[model samples]
Structures are given as C-alpha cells and as structure tokens.
Target: MSIQAASNSEKPPQEDNYQPPSSLSSLPDDVVLNCLARVPRSDDLNISCVSKTLRSLVRSPELCRLRSRLPKKSLYLFYHFHQDSKRCHWITLRRGEKMITSTHDYQVEQRSCSLAGLLTSPHFPTFYSSGVSVGSEIYFPDHGWPFPSTKVRVLDTRSGTIRMVPSMKVARWAHKKAMGVVDGKIYVIGGTYGKNQVEVLDPETQTWEFAGEEKVQCNSRFSAPLEDKVYMVDLEHGRISAYSPREGINNVATERLIEHMNCMCVVENVIYACFKRSGLMWFDTKLKVWRRLIDSGGKATLCSFNAGKMAEYEGKLAVFWTQINTNFVEKVDIRCRIIALDRVGEEIRGKIESSGSVATCSYSITLSHCLVVSD
Candidate 1:
C-alpha cells in the first residue's frame, strides 16, 4: 500500500469541529507521530473515518519519516505441495496484505496471518531447500537435487508471487545456500557437478554467464556472501573459506567447525549457523573461532531448529521453523521469532523480541526457504 507523503513544512491540520480523544491527542506530537507510523496502511480508510485528527495524522509527513526509520522485516515462507513441482507457494509470516494470483506454472497465495503461515513442497527436503533473496527477488536454480538443470526461478516478495526466468547457460548443481548476490547481480556458487564454477545472472536482462572458476577445496552445498566476497565453510577440516570475485582471490580459510547445520546466513558481517539439534552459532572472523550464541541474559537459548530456515529481518535475526502438531490430525505449524542482537566487547548477544506460530496447516509440508524482504 502506498501513501502520498505530506509536506514537512505544513503541520497536520487540526480539527476545528470534531475533537479527538484526549488520551491520544494529549500526547506529544513526536510520540503521536510515531504511533501513527506504526498503524497499518490497510487501516487508513478506517482511521480517516474515525476522526479528523486521526486522518491528519495519517497524512502527516512526520508519519512517513518515522515509518521509514522503522525496520521493514517482511518475512516470506516458500513451500509447495509434496506432489507438485509445477508450482511454488510463498506465504508471508506476518499479518496484513492478502493476495492470491496464479502464473502459468506456479500458484501464488499470500496472506499475513496473525496465527501461522502455510507452505507445501514435494520437491524433496534434502536439496533445493532454501533460496537467497536479492532485494525484491529470490533466486533458486531449477536443480531439485538428485537432478540438475540449467533452469532458474525467481520469486517476488511484494505479493508472495513467483515465476521462472530464462534458464542459465550452464546447469548449477549446487544446493542450499549456493546462491548469493554481489553488486546487485545474482551469483551461484557451484557449477555443474560440484565444480568451483560460478554462474552470474543479470536480473535486468534475465541472462546468465559463467564466472572464472576458483580452486575451491570441495563442493560446498551452502555458501554465503560478505564484504563483497563469497564464503564456503568446510567444518570437517575446520576451515572457513572466503573467495573474492572483485579482487580475484581464492577463498581464505579460517578455523571453524559446523556439522548438521540446517542453514547459515550473514547478519551484520557475521555468519550465523543453525543446527537441527544444536540451537545457534556464529563464526567470529576476527578470532577465527566458532562460538555458541548467547541470549541477553548471558545464557544459551534453547531453540530446536528442526528443518528450520532463517534470514535477516528488520535489522534483526528472524528464525523460522516447522513442527508437527501432535494433538490434532496430521498438521504442521510454521513458527517465527524475531531476535534483537547486541554486541558487548567480544561477545554477541541475542534476545527474542517476539515468538509465535504464524500458520497451521492440515497437510504435511516441507519448508524450502524463509526470506526477509523490505517493504
């Protein structure tokens, strides 16, 4: 939803006839403006109908300024039915913006549910599990594990819609976090048959070309982008490799260990890894050591991330996970949590700001990705 920004020079018009409630209008202007910024645009019509004071607040330029300052951490969940590959379903884990559309190959349905978000995928959970979001688009190679292809699919987070782009010239067999964006271009970390080949995609032209191959130690299923370079971690040998395409440098490895990691992503230049059994961990590039994540209370957080996916949301860490509902008939619950992170000297702390189930579904589902997009 879009709202025209009111000029900052003019103050919100005061109501000459209808007076607003004293409890609200009595507050300081800046505080009132911040509250108005949090109000959903979908309710603008209702807010206008309520009172003239409210309408002026909605149209105030200060509202836009405060809203822009607020972090826009829109979280989208990607999943499809267990029996279909011709379709992908993307659902937002927040409340508001209900949309339903269908493309030639995929069916798009999105609703920000106050309860839980739903997604289904029969595409095998072992591969094609998650995607990397670049701005408004999320890129995933057509390869669905066990099978490799040159095709690619892109999802738009604005309406929870998805579509297929032109196929890449070379098939990318990489899975999981093998895709990242550098300088606005989508980069796939691995090439056909686990080679160190990289494929670059220009979203504007919907075209792809192969990048110079780097001497990577092994075929990594997951990779991350940081500081203009891509990183691949090999925990078996305690090596976290960094590759620089801009500088044409092969990735340098530091000491780190990760095993059974469900997903890993970069947040504030730190690489956070989530395990199914273990809670959360981050790689310390400065000390070249791996540390378990600590909460604000200086204690380890007990979070079971079984088949979980994570992304950066609103300048904070957003965690998504799925669990089978035991009390009811075969059903799945998609859960979400927002974590505010803090740094104290050498230790990084995390505090879960909010936690709840976003959606519950009757059908068994496999979560493919959890993406955080800006509004």
Candidate 2:
C-alpha cells in the first residue's frame, strides 16, 4: 500500500474549498456584543483574548443585558489586600474611559484566602471589610480591634461560593461600617458595635438577626439603600437616620449636616453623600433637603476611599481602595485602583488621588460570583 500510501487512502474529501463567515455578514451577534461593550477597558481586555467570536463576546450575558440598557456602562475595579492570605484586583472601565483605562485594562484574579478561616476569633480579628452586591450575591461584614465577634459573609459573586453568618449582639467594629439591601434583607449599619449596632442578614435564611442598637454614637454616619429606605449618617453629630425593615424596629433620627461626612450612596432615589475631607451631599428623600453637590478638596485625603466598598457600576459610583502596608518589599508593588464615580459628573476632583496611609490595618474582601455564562 505504498504509492505515497495509496494516494492517502484515496483522498475522498474536497468541497471546492471553504466558505463560512456570513451570519448576515458583520454586526448582529447582539450588535457585535453592543459594539464590544463600547470597547475600551483596553480593548475589552484584548478582545477577550481574540477568537471564539471574541471569547463569546468577552464573556457575554447578552453583554450584561446590553450593559443594562446603557445609561453608561463598564466599571469593575475591586482590589483587596487586607491580607491574611487573600488578594484581589479587578478592572473594567468604559464610561468616557481613561485613567489610562485603569492602568491599561487591569485584571489580576487571585485566590488563596483565609482571613483566619474567616474568623471565629483569633481573639477578634478583621479591621476593614465591606461589600454588597446581592442578586448574584456579595455581602460582607467584619470590623476588628480587640472587638469583633460578629462576623458575616455571603459570596457567590458568580460562584467563588462561601456562606457564613451569625454575629449581631454587638462586639465592636466601626471604622466605617454600613451595608444595605432591604427586601431580601441585609441591613447592617453604624459599626463600632459596642453601642450602635443595627444588623440583619437573611441571604435566603442564613440568618443573623438583630435590628436595634443606636442610642447615639459617633460612627453612625453611613448607611444607604433607598426605595424601602435605609439611610443612616451622622457626620460626627449632625445626624441623618431612616430605617424601615418592613416597618418594625423603626428609626428616624435627624439633626441635619454641617459637613465632614465622607461616604454614602443610594443612587436613582438619591442620597449620595461624600464629604470626603469635606464637601458633597445630596439627601432629599422626598424633600428632607441637604443639597450641596460637589467639593471634595477642602483638605483632601479621603482615606483610600472605601465607602463600604461602594458599587453601582455601569451607572457610575464604583469604589475600591483599602490595602496599603507597603515596605515588606513594597508589599509586592502594591497596586489597587478602581474608582469610577461620575454618574452625572461632579466629584473626581484633583483627578485620581490616593497614595499612602495605613495604620494597623487588617483586611478581607471576597466577592466571588463568576459564571461568564454557560447554562
């Protein structure tokens, strides 16, 4: 059978060449994935690594439902390094893009976690934690000192999967604690739990109840999730409260603001306060009034901007930064940048500033929920 192997078994395959590229020619795979999600997060991470129709249009969910019907989309930056063996870094920005497109389309997903097995108490540990995504799940809780027995965790950011809940009798933890997601329940406000504790968690019944603990504290100054109401701000002592767990443990403190607040959110229904170093407020829940608007340069030093790890992405208000312990060989080049705040434009003042300052910092931020799409 040798004639170059019998003409290679009589070569019986040849369809006059090839032709397969017309799915109606050009656009229309959901409009080429909404023009590649408005491209520019460094060319959508290099066209999601080219080929495969652009890694299925850069991991599409109908391109996140056509970027939630566009009001402006693309901004995902999550960087956590309050290390105990946990590291995080994410980036995606396409709203008038350019902060060097987040240091050139950032993406460094890592995992080797352990905030001490998420704490049961290494004598109370957890000095900075905040997260709340819900729906695809992402809830966080844990603030430490010589006090932090109340812990909370519920992540499935897609499926890094984890569930641990139980801690709301107040054990202390408030350097800026505030979380909200009313209806499916998850309202935790006014940290430093030794006195102003208001907690609630029910990620479909993982339970961690207790909603009442605030008889006046200095750190009850940040908690927002409007619609069913859940706004708490103290600004040191100018107050601003509103809670309604389907109308039960009612609370409605008010003293108004004078300034010096530094973090808050409630988008769409409005209640965004960011008096970072001083300046920016907008609370009008049906005219309670406090409009100031923009000005965060009074003293400037928004403490690495971590308003409970703020997030309203695609519609603006994306925040991240809490991990600076430099000089352990420069903490391996310490780099975390995810701040895209411009839902309607106002405060991005001095344009991206945050360099150093972390005294006695302990951290943990886990928001695992990844499925790209494959049913």
Query: How does residue 285 of candidate 1 score in lDDT?
Result: 81
User: For model 1, how does the per-residue alpha-carbon lDDT over 95-141 read when each residue is reduced to its tens digit?
Assistant: 33452221111122354211112112225223443366777777766
lDDT over C-alpha atoms for residue 155 of model 2 = 49
Global lDDT of model 1: 0.64
- Span of ten consecutive residues with least summed lDDT in model 1: 112-121
Best by TM-score: 1
Residue runs of model 2 more than 4 Å from their true location after superposition: 1-9, 12-30, 33-35, 41-94, 97-138, 144-148, 151-375
Best prediction by lDDT: 1
Error of 2 at 111 (Å): 29
